[model samples]
Target: MKYDPIDSNLFKKNRKKFMAQMKPSSLAVFNSNDVFKTGADSTMPFKQHRDIFYLSGADQEDTVLVLFPDCPDPAHREVLFVTETNDHIAVWEGEKLTKEKATEVTGIETVYWLKDLDKKFFEMMTQCDTVYFNTNEHYRQAVEMETREDRFIKKTKAQYPAHNYAKSAPILQRLRAVKEPEELELLQKACDITNHSFRRVLDFVKPGVWEYEIEAEYLHEFIRRRSDGFAYTPIIASGNNANVLHYIENNQQCKDGDLILMDVGAVYANYSADMSRTIPVNGRFTDRQKQVYNAVNKVKNEATAMLVPGTLWKEYHVEVGKLMTSELLDLGLLDKADVQNENPDWPAYKKYFMHGTSHHIGLDTHDYGLLWEPMQANNVFTVEPGIYIPQEGFGIRLEDDVVIQESGAPKNLMGDIPIEVEEIEDLMNK
Candidate 1:
């Protein structure tokens, strides 16, 4: 919990939106993420489930949120179940949230101990006809490990087989896709922190510096600014390592006249900002590198324009592909024959630019948005386009976080951050 406390109104509004979508007499439950084990006694740092955090603003582990708007008892309408913190437990694990503070953080009037959940939840389950179960239904999700929410679904089904079960994922998917004004404020803060880190790295990076050192510079800035950390695993690949896509090793030394592809961001109040930028270690891109860099930047700018409202997610990428193809042609990386002979599934542009151009981004890096649906306002996305040339020992990518607007183009969250080749070089040399 390195970040500052979020405004409870955001959570309150989120809960209101969720409840409005629920069918009459239906109750919903959201579970915090489990603290994963690294080894026997070693456990990975606790990360709150984004959904619970979204609804309740409760960042603590082992917490549960119950929404029973139609409960017979008025006090049971909205409740938070937090682990009870006693004197002995406080001494062992530091201080956890107390009942008073839990109410303050969540704006939930009723708070109960985790020990009282089963008895109370059973009482509500019998009163309600349907239960809204939280499940991960993001398109990119390939969850192999059974999550806390999964176990809850299984156990609840067995416990109340007669009660109708409903999916909360669909409601959440649509709701979380649209950002509230308060959510945007937190996301902007994350982007501003990332901007500071990127500027610091620009000055710190030079020939002979290890790639991991640059990664350290980014994390140091993020931590000092009170960001939880990188939104996802950072990619600090230097020179040809940038072509490898998911290069987290960051062990290679940066050389003069080479580009470093940093796909990094910061998380503030659990909201994510994703950015990717390629910069020359020597603070000046060579003639050939400048050509490739501008091409990618051009592609990025054009791709971002496609994120406006009412655009299909798949259609936007296809249009972006055409944009990239034109840039690749001008860069002499692809010719007319290469474009003509390319397979429909794997286009000619995939040779230099393999991965996707944009993805929904917010709570998670690859966040919740139905890919099959048309783009809408308040939907945040990242525009990342890269041209990787392994043979030339360099890769170029330029990215910015953007929000889909009601009309015109999406607003670029990272627009203030330096991106032009001249601007980056001048900032680094300064």
Candidate 2:
């Protein structure tokens, strides 16, 4: 891990919260993500499963966590199973976590080797009345590839068909939605790193710089600030390229008159921050570009104000659409006729700002939170609003991560980053 270690108390608290929701006399299991293969000899980087990481603070692959709060033996209540490290494995790969290190990282005193799992698990299965299966239940999930957790769930069902089974997703969703104080601290650290990266790009960007060059500048700043890397794949699209929502081919040279849309953020200790900003490549937006940019910025500001506790996720977007429509009308992109004649399914605002204005952001870039439920305090989200105009050969978007406060409006974590046209221009010219 490039970043510093996280405090294990957060994991301990997470485990307690999760166990509180489990049925009595039942056990829950979580598995680390697989190290996917790219070719015969190559493999993709290993990313720890967020659920296990949240509960155990174990970031390595082939690790397992078993929680049985009602166990007769207190030490066995919260157990960790890790891959045993040997001389050969250590020499060939790297230093795998030792039993002592695993205990330190996870706060679970009982650590066992992977080899002893089957024998140990068989004994525990008979002792418990029910088993909790960890399944992906995110609203936007389209999981085709079977994860290690999925395979474990299938195998456990086949082995013990008579045992009662339950889904752990519901409990996890509710618990993970509200951030602990420690988690909020880590997430704030991530947003602070993103601020450094964006500020660096403000000075480096100019008319002649390529889009890829600006992306490189952000990456450079992120590493300097001890961030692991971007929270997600970044989009550094300029001019009409910005119209492509997910554009990542940043090969175009930024023209002086065009605006560059950069959607990027940094990750630290598995926590994520998401931000998007559109700036002129020439260190100044043209008159018309400023108009569109200010419109998008206004929508972003208003939309963020609506992310208070008790706000419904569905209703929040409807309100954002109204805000975007009013801004678009003021910018001359939509008229009175465009408002009335537009289809109800796709409002007049869709013609300019097509995508959702915000989404829950945290551990993962698009973090987990039940959309059907009302928003709550400590639930972090991204307020991003944009105007894509292929006809004008440019697009503008502004986004920032915010934490919903218990009282009053949500607090913007990226508040230090420059966004207003005057602030951005002054910084760039400096």
Candidate 3:
């Protein structure tokens, strides 16, 4: 692993919290992600399942975590089943986590090999009345691919037909939403990397640079800073490309006076930082560009202040919509009559700023959090507000990761990253 070791206590605390939420006599299982293959013998990089990684801190393939909080043997309460490495695996794929190292990483003293999972899990199942199966219940998830957890759930249910089943997603969604101090530290590192990379791009961006060239600059900075890379497929959208919300081709040449919208971030130790900034392709934003940029920046700042504890996610966005609506009206994108006859559901702001104002940001870029629940202190979210005008041939979005506070304003992780028109211009010119 390129990243520094995470304190195993974070994983321990996570598992303890998760296990506390489980019903009595219930055993939970979490499986690492399958090593996805692209073609014959070629494989996509192994990314561990965020749930398992969150609870176990074991970022490896072919690993499983079982939490039987009510097990008769206390030592077996938290067990990790890892891929046992031999000479061939070590020689070919490098070092897999040995039992000692797995224990050191996960704080789970009891470890088993993958081959023993079935027999051992079956034995544990006989003692527990219900089994908690980790499932994908994230709002944005549209997984067509069957995950390792899915396979495990199928086999477990078929093998133990009489056992009651439960979903672990709900508990996990609540637990993972609030960050521990250690998790926050890791996230801060990711955001700091993103901040530096954005600065690097500011210096690198020019009138004639290709959008992909900008993406490459970000990637280079991220790698040099020990980041795994972009939190998601980067959107280096220049000019009209910004109108297409998910534009990631990054192939178009940036023209002078055009604004480039970069929706990019860096990942540190599987934690994610999501940020979006629209900047001038040239050293300075044109007067019209600055007008739109300031509107988005104003909305972003106002929206961020509403992220304190007890704010509901949906209501917060509605409030943010109101803010964006006012900004758009001021920018001449919306009129008073447009607001008067606006569809209550769609609203007049959709004409210029269509996307949600914010979302939870953590292990996954769009991380898991109960949307219906009130925001809590320590919960992290992105405050991204945008104004897109295809007719103007450019869009403006400004984003920053923030942590909701109990008493005051949410802490902006990207606070140091330049967003002001003057600051950005100064950096670009320098």
lDDT of each: 0.91, 0.91, 0.92
Cα lDDT of model 1 by residue, 168-207, tens digit: 9999999999999988888999999999999899889889
| Residue pairs clashing, model 1 | none
RMSD to native for every prediction? 1.0, 1.1, 0.8
Per-residue CA lDDT of model 3 for 1-430, tens digit only, reads: 7798888999999999999999999999998999999999999988889999999999999999999999998977999999888999999999999999999999999999989987888789889999999899999999998888888888888899999999999999999999998999999999999999999998898889999999999999999999988889999999999999999899999999899999999999999999999998888888889988988888888989899999999888888888888888888889999999999989999988888988898999999999999999999999988888999899888899999988988899888988899999999998
For all candidates, the clash counts are 0, 0, 0
Those runs of model 2 whose alpha carbons end farther than 4 Å from true positions after fitting are none
TM-score of 1: 0.98
Worst 10 residues of 1 by lDDT: 1-10
Q: What residue pairs are clashing in model 2?
A: none
**Candidate 2 C-alpha lDDT tens digits along 1-430:** 8888888898999999999999999999999999999989899988889999999999999999999999877777988999999999999999999999999988899999988999888888988989998899888888899899989988999999999999889998888889998888889999999898888899888888998898899889888888888888999998899999999989999988889999999999999989999999888888999988888888888888899989999999999898888888888889999999999999998987889988888788888899989999999999999999999999998999999999998899999989999999999998
| TM-scores of all candidate predictions against the true structure | 0.98, 0.98, 0.99
